[model samples]
Target chain A: MDAYEDLQQATLHDIPRSECLQLLGVARVGRIVFADDEGPVALPVNFRMDGESVLFRVSPASEMCLRLNEAKVSFQVDRLDDFHQTGWSVLVRGTSSYVESEDLPVLRSTRPLPWARGFRPVYVRVQPTQISGRRLVDD
Target chain B: MDAYEDLQQATLHDIPRSECLQLLGVARVGRIVFADDEGPVALPVNFRMDGESVLFRVSPASEMCLRLNEAKVSFQVDRLDDFHQTGWSVLVRGTSSYVESEDLPVLRSTRPLPWARGFRPVYVRVQPTQISGRRLVDD
Candidate 1:
């Protein structure tokens, strides 16, 4: 029971994972970050949350996807408006994998696809380990 | 002058590095991506641009800040709206390094600080490699 208690305490103190998915649902475009031996890279991706995971596509020969799926990855999605001084963000850490075409249909209806060419859209999915989020509550 | 001509040709085909600053000048918040051994991560940051680099801050111990600045980094400033389905994005690939207090003046005055906080905001500069960008012109 001690380990269970500790896990509960940590999860309680941290931002809820569900909030991260909620924020992702509201945002259609956000940047994805990847870290590899070469260094850290951030790129803009049009994404939609699939269940608890994140799904997005890029052109073939994508440098970001190539690195992300090959390593433990983290994706940060945030939206902020300077004028309003209000915004929210969500970050997910996990391993990324390529989403096969056979699995696309279940995701397509809910996922907001980018305007970029889709005929060969290479999809990448990030399965989360820990998810956290923050937001500036509007007055 | 053949080398210069070749360079000029490359610039013509790609977005000029200087133009990045120009586009940044008109924007206030940008998405920042970082990675640390982990794959990729992205988040929105309230930032401004220097001549060839972009600057933003994070709180002490912030995951985004720590994971980034470890080595080669990439930050992107982009805008997308569903209605028009068109927007421009600037991706900066550079080493993420801290700007100490002594150097703040030079970095601060390069552009107005749109994002600040009571907590000591760690300043980071992203020097870019390729600054190519595209938009959905007719979408």
Candidate 2:
């Protein structure tokens, strides 16, 4: 309704797959979304990008462990700055499964050391079938 | 594995409703989880706390506009510090509906001025039917 709002164009533009993966590699945290009995649930997890998959650990009995296998899941990461009100978000839709015990040792050096304390022994990997991202910027 | 890891108990504790709402009020950004044709999606939105509900604006043709209203949705806000490896997360499960035209004026004073440009005229309000939160701390 005002001149400033009228003149400002905050355009939303798509970022390519290569760039989306780059952003995912750099982000330290992301939210994993999966279905629950009630509906959808989104929970924060420190994640690491390995090849084309995202890897994270959860408690053995956590909902993530119970529900996030062979299930359609989405993982999202973003950088939002309150001062500038500008940010980029990347969303990945994928199939997730628990990492077998045999593959666990290889991820020992992954960057995202779990921030949550306790025995988070179950490792989950999400192999994205589709990745898309968008950025909001002043034009 | 180490004494330090054993001694540093990362405790998980519940956050009360009053405090959960307080955290919701102070945080400027949160993720909304909803179901889509493919599966579930988690997208970040700059939001404001309105009494027991959260309000945000989106474009008319955006996926949020199509899938958000009259749907079971979850909104999450959190603070994570990697250095300390400690954070608090609040999750709100609720039903969202587009703000009626008659009620628009009252929400005009809310804190988050949508950063994305053009006219984001579709305003959404999510009224929480269930609110739960957890805090991770080093004890």
Candidate 3:
């Protein structure tokens, strides 16, 4: 409605897969989205990129460990600037499953460390079938 | 594994609905989780708490405008402290519908302003069927 509002206008751009992966690799925290009996749920998790998949840990007794195995899920990471009103978000759609027992040793040494206090021994990996991202910037 | 790791142990607590609503009222940004044709997706949006509902605006042509109307969705808002490893997250699960036209004038004056440049004329409101939250604090 005013000149400042015009200045606040932004353009949205599609980020390529490679760039999306790069962003994911650098970000340490993201929201993992999945459905429960009620509906969709999004919860934050500390994550690390393992090749093209996302690797994180949850408590073996947690609902995530119980419901996420082999389920279609989405992982979202973003950097938002409230002052500048600019940001980018990447979404990874994939199937989540427990990491194989054989890979635990190496992954334990190299994967993301959970920030929560309790033991998060069950490692889950989301193998993305589709990765997409978008960026919003001043026009 | 170490003394510092032991110090980093956090305790998780269930926050009551009153506290969750209080937190939601003060937060300006959140992720909306909904299912598309592919699966679950979480996208960041600037939103406001409307009574017990969540209100946000999106482009009429956007997928959110099309898929979110009359759809069951979840809106999640959180505050994370990477340094202290403490945070709280609140989730609202409910059905979304376009804000009725008659109430637009008054609602528009008090609603959350979208940061992105573009016309966001379609106002969507998610009326919560359930609200839950949790907090992680240093033990």
> Model 1, residue A55: what's the lDDT?
85
Q: In candidate 1, residue B86 scores what lDDT?
A: 55
DockQ of each: 0.26, 0.60, 0.62
TM-score of chain A of each: 0.75, 0.91, 0.92
- TM of each candidate vs. truth: 0.75, 0.91, 0.91
Q: Judging by lDDT, tell me the better candidate of 1 and 3.
A: 3
Task: Compute the lDDT for candidate 2.
Answer: 0.83
Q: Against the true structure, whose DockQ is highest?
A: 3
Local accuracy of candidate 1 as per-residue lDDT tens digits, B1-139 = 1122222111112346567678777777876666545455666667776666777776667776676554577777777665555566777767778776676545434543433333435777776765766554542
Residue pairs that clash (backbone atoms under 3 angstroms), model 1: A33-B40, A33-B41, A33-B42, A34-B39, A34-B40, A34-B41, A35-B39, A72-B39
Model 1 chain A weakest lDDT span, ten residues long: A3-12
Write the residue-wise lDDT of candidate 3 on A1-139 in tens digits.
4334555576788999999999998888898999888778899998889889999889988877888989999999988776777899999999999997676546454677788778877789999999999999877
Can you tell me which runs of candidate 3 are displaced by over 4 Å? A1-7, A105-107, B1-7, B105-107
**Over the stretch A1-139, how does candidate 1's per-residue lDDT look in tens digits?**
1122222111112247776677777777766677656666666666877878888876666566567655677777776667765677788888788887777646345644655543335778888887888665443
Candidate with the larger TM-score of 1 and 2: 2
Candidate 2 C-alpha error for residue A115, in Å: 1.4
